[model samples]
Target: MKGLSWLSRLAGGLVRLEGRKFTSLKRCQDDHFLTPSKGESALYIHIPFCRQPCLYCSFHRYQFHEDIARRYFRNLRTEIDLYLDRGFRFAHIYLGGGTPTVMMDELASLLSHLKSRLGGAVISLETNPSDITSKNIALLKELGVGRLSVGVQSFNDRLLKAMGRTSHTGVEAQEKVRLAQGNFETLNIDILYNLPDQPPEVFRNDIAMVRELEVDQVTFYPLMPPLNRGDPLPPSLKPDNRCEGLFYKMILEEMYDGGYQPSTAWCFSRGRMMIDEYIVDYGDYIAVGCGAVGFFGGGLYANTFSLDRYSHMLEKGGLPVALFRGLSRSEASRYRLLTTLFGMGIRGDGFPRRFGDSPSNGIQSLVGLLQFLGVVECDGEELRVTAGGMMVVSRMMREFFSALNRLREYCLRYGI
Candidate 1:
């Protein structure tokens, strides 16, 4: 058993090394599976500036810097030009950030350039409630932004403070939501449950708050433990297993009672609104900015995490891609399985016919075990994760990570 584990790790390491080499030479570009037939694509532009970093955020973000930001935006325009020259047409654009609303003027400029290039696209900008003033909202609407994704991490003031967020109070957040409800075609609010000090009732009330807001969509995500490589356990908040389980249970019960459909594990919709429908459908996206990841063709590429490095690369007429991987057929199939099973809670029968066989035999066996354990159900055509499975999607994803870790260990010990 020990030998086998080592062998798996060795193989995984070799695969990772090969991926690194491929990324270094930008050779992974050939593996992209562009959806030419779709003719439409999604665009994700990462605005890394934030008022302050959240305690639990693992994404690459930095505090506000005007000079640096201006430089970054220039590079961003260059990056967009690269894609425009490639004859890509985008239909949806998402500006995600540390807080996109922080740099309203810059964001508007970026959107203006994109609109001039793409003609028209459904633009969504993620923001915090405090940043969504009347003036900024009007500016966004004028700039052709139709959707707003508010980061209302939690309605609880205590939790909000703990999360290092100071944008708005619960009441203020509600007011912002009200303002955005009619203005934006789609309004998606993000809420987090299972903080270190939160209880089940608190989470229930949070859902009730969402119900009261009557926003188009609500994304309920459990608190993820800090992922900083150095400090495994950050002092701000810790993950509680029991509280997490109860939190999810409460969310499911309340959301269902509120007449929201489980669009995905973390996503719930009240009406027929589809905020991120393109990703679930066969659409393409271009991710630009530091630490932003883009999916094109069958390839996944990420820009440099360092702000300076990313800017320098882009200024030098490079893609700023620090790491990229060409997904093999099997790897792409596994990626789809992971995304679908966890995201939409639905698996397609056409997947197997399109991507060689069903997920690997190993994955099938794991799915069968999960089914027997009552975490999932298989109707032979489509597989669905039960409420229990949804509650532990994080754990299930971790299991895949564990398997990958074992594989990595094996590969490291024995050359693949």
Candidate 2:
């Protein structure tokens, strides 16, 4: 119908009316259920403890205490064992968090276990600006960290203060980057944009800062405030999707002119390097630790958000799985299409090779739909995200994460 065609164009061309239902979860006991596959997958470790919880952060986290953190680390190792015992093998490991470097020894121990077992698997880690110490950097290198991503949302003091991140100054953040730049194979900095009052000029300076630091990679995140129902935040801290799109327009021009390449929809790098996005690189990753999520074997799995629940379940010799849903065949195909296109675009044969069906099987008619709208361009051999399509992908991802953040908000609030 003419009306249906008009609606698809409005929804940005990758619309899914309903998603998978993951209401049921099973107790993860032995390795038999987690059969190994021939494909290589990455293992994601979520460090859920933070020195201070940022007000706008949506990921599940708790304030760090030495005693409790040490216990959490021990449990993390136990969780890793659960996967290994279940016949899973990871060629790469990504450590993400509420500041994975908050406790040095625990981080070191976890890496030690991984190195001994996985045998030179690539390791990646995340940290806050405060953790970028010479000692910490040295330790990270010693631990085989190939990629290090630092979350420096803004170099503007005003924005940093507004975000409740006061531990380090903008100057100190640059100094830390100076120290971290050459130590790892890839050094990536994360910057935030589209704040309540962030001007185009301020964002431009942040990009200049990236070049000045000479960091290998950069990831710009449009502000997606977490879902919360407590005292309201200032209007300045809220998200402006319209404003976000404008900033994204600037990113496309600035980064491209600067000679950076797309590592993902948001990540740009000066040279080839490992990106922090497991989703962009690996289709089927296993996420562990409280509040983490994973996709493997045609199903999506979620770990508990509550520390108490996470620890208790793992200690009882279970996988801490809180939710599980098997994606429909079409859903799986569409997912592959979404993620691949988010990066360098998809090879024409990618869908059929991965999903055993043509792109039309999962994407439905959206192929012709998006191409018709100038959102994407297709050569029979490949489909690539065009300059115009960047904003579309940005909004699409923002909406998806917003929904997930809502779930995180509810779980953390009611202790679900």
Candidate 3:
């Protein structure tokens, strides 16, 4: 384990350098790049309106506005129509937010409309602790939401207050977790660790809460605040690597002890769990809401972060893509490999079917290097991250998302 730890850190350093290069922004060389195809891809709808923007959040979200939200819903339906008209089929929907459950009525209407198009599909929605009322929970279940993930950053009142997220007390957070529990196929509690000056015990208590509540799934995220060029970094978000590592180790230990298996590097659950992370599950997806990003047809495309621009573009009957970066064959394959590893393994036997030829044909060096360093091993035709390599994969995935978050910052800032 110690040797794997050292190699993982070394791999993290190398991956960080590659991530920086891979995520560097390029001008939108092609505005008319989207070409709808008859492929299966998940749909991600961004709810840009939030009741309140957390101090540490930089995702595309606005202070909630009722009238604007109503219009946004209408425009969102139109945006979905644009893709459907082109024969693009999506059977999985992941709703991310400002807060998807804030305007429940409109959200339900929107989901109904999406179901009409897809002829019914699984839906996963993200919500805040404050929105976990019996009414909202019931309404979401009625809307056929298979997964409900509540963001409860911490169970410690002091940490919640320190993070400026005391809108709900620690007690309220726990009650909400129980309230939302058992209502969906998978109830996921989103926890944050490596918080600035956060003690290891706080995370231990969080794991305890998960076990006590018997929540279906838990996602523990290491704090990965995007470095903004214009905005000064917040003092409260300075995360320590040692703390993160310790907390993750504790999480793996506790979850496994409790019979929770890892569904992803950061996500653990007792049984089948609905995952909202589209990347880990799908190689390509279409993001429909403002401030969302999509990867399809060998390119990474982002929708406009500006609500007005988004609605206007849909008003004019056009896709809301503001920028795009086309990926080469190598970039695409390596991306697939990374996300596959993040999900715990790469099925080598199916490599020819998914990417043509074999794993050795494109990213051979990467697979070999991982094996060479004991970071991963081949189980017949499947390659999986070793116990020691989870953190290494986590670091790499975190850096990749950090890079995308930087892209999100640009989109949010310039309203692109």
Candidate 4:
């Protein structure tokens, strides 16, 4: 029995060692880029309530219930007060969620609290097309909201139904965009491509629609499978490689023809470039609400994903933080790289200045390869993704991830 107990202890030790190794590897890969010398402060508020969950969405969202929302908002106010006491100053505020508009009163209260704490800040809110009414638009304008990111997904009714979106139709979406333009300085539309049963021609038509709408910016994201393994995928959409590649290419061509520039791997813009400016300048932000992640003061943290838990935490005078990680210098660097690549699509020559050391050979080689593929072109010293490359930005990001993974595996195997 003693021998058996000793064996069990040995097994436990091995398991712990493996876990530590894995964590270390992940940390190293995450921190491979340079940390910003001066970090920006941004606020993000997550509204977990949604009218209904879209089939492909896995974000932490709940169905609209006034009682639940009211409780959540009360807790959120408490959380904000706690942060303000901690001396956190934020410049950018983002309200995102299942549907932020669903909790209009709560949103107003939260914004009021934020204004009291931070004074003047660049406030942005993301909402579904269905939620944007004239009243909501008026409220947003009155709140001094500078940006509105509307989730339009697609203009085609068939495609929208296939994607299981309960929001506005294509026509309704256009009207909302028109309404939003009158108030917000930056109006952004979020569109998705490679949807189930979406044809190549649909993308071309969508681009035309975007051009006609003449909004400030457009974000084009490819369809990502729902994170829940048990959720059944649509019959028209499979994880097939060829179908995805073709659709991606078609979307890229259409976007380029419409004169939309790539701001991130999955985002594009037209008039005023908000994302590019943020990434390049390292704009500060604050993130609030359930499952919303925030970076400030050289640390990254996320709120609790559970609504009940989050509310309880707030009531107890604690931030609804389920996970918190203070980034080491190396970890901050890697995050910057990932953010820069995904956000701005610009490879700056001033890597050593931003990060601490020169760019790794692996990253340089990847850039070179991308350049060779005609996906990126060298403008003087700056590396910019070309139109062709923008189509497969997700694939490119995967390639970066692959390299990071390899590095991690090597570190684990050799105990580095």
Best by TM-score: 3
Q: Rank the candidates by TM-score, best first.
A: 3, 2, 1, 4
Give lDDT: candidate 3, residue 290. Answer: 87
* Cα lDDT, all candidates: 0.68, 0.77, 0.80, 0.64
**Candidate 3 CA-lDDT value:** 0.80
What are the runs in model 1 whose C-alpha is more than 4 Å off? Answer: 1-38, 227-234, 273-279, 282-284, 345-385, 392-394, 397-416
Report the poorest 10 consecutive residues by lDDT, candidate 4. 25-34
| Model 2 local distance difference test score | 0.77
Cα lDDT for residue 137, model 2?
92
Model 4 residue 400 lDDT score: 40
Clashing pairs in 2: 31-86
lDDT of 1 by residue, 267-354 (tens): 8887784646445444246788876766667766666667787787777776776545666655555556555655644556844443
The lDDT of model 1 is 0.68
lDDT (0-100) at residue 170 of candidate 4?
Answer: 86
Cα RMSD, each candidate? 7.0, 3.4, 2.1, 10.7
Q: What pairs collide in candidate 3?
A: none
How high is each candidate's TM-score?
0.80, 0.92, 0.94, 0.78
Model 2, 1-416: lDDT tens digits are 22222332355333323321232334343323345688678999999888978877767777999998888899989999988887789988999988899899989989999988888988889899999999999989999998999999888898888888887878889988898988988999999888887889989998988887778999888788854748688787788665666688788888988888877778899977446778877889898999887878777777888888888988988887776667777776766766776775766666445556455474747667777877678886577887777677766666556556765775666665
lDDT of 4 by residue, 100-126 (tens): 878788788788878887889898888
Give me the displacement of residue 194 in model 4, in angstroms: 1.1
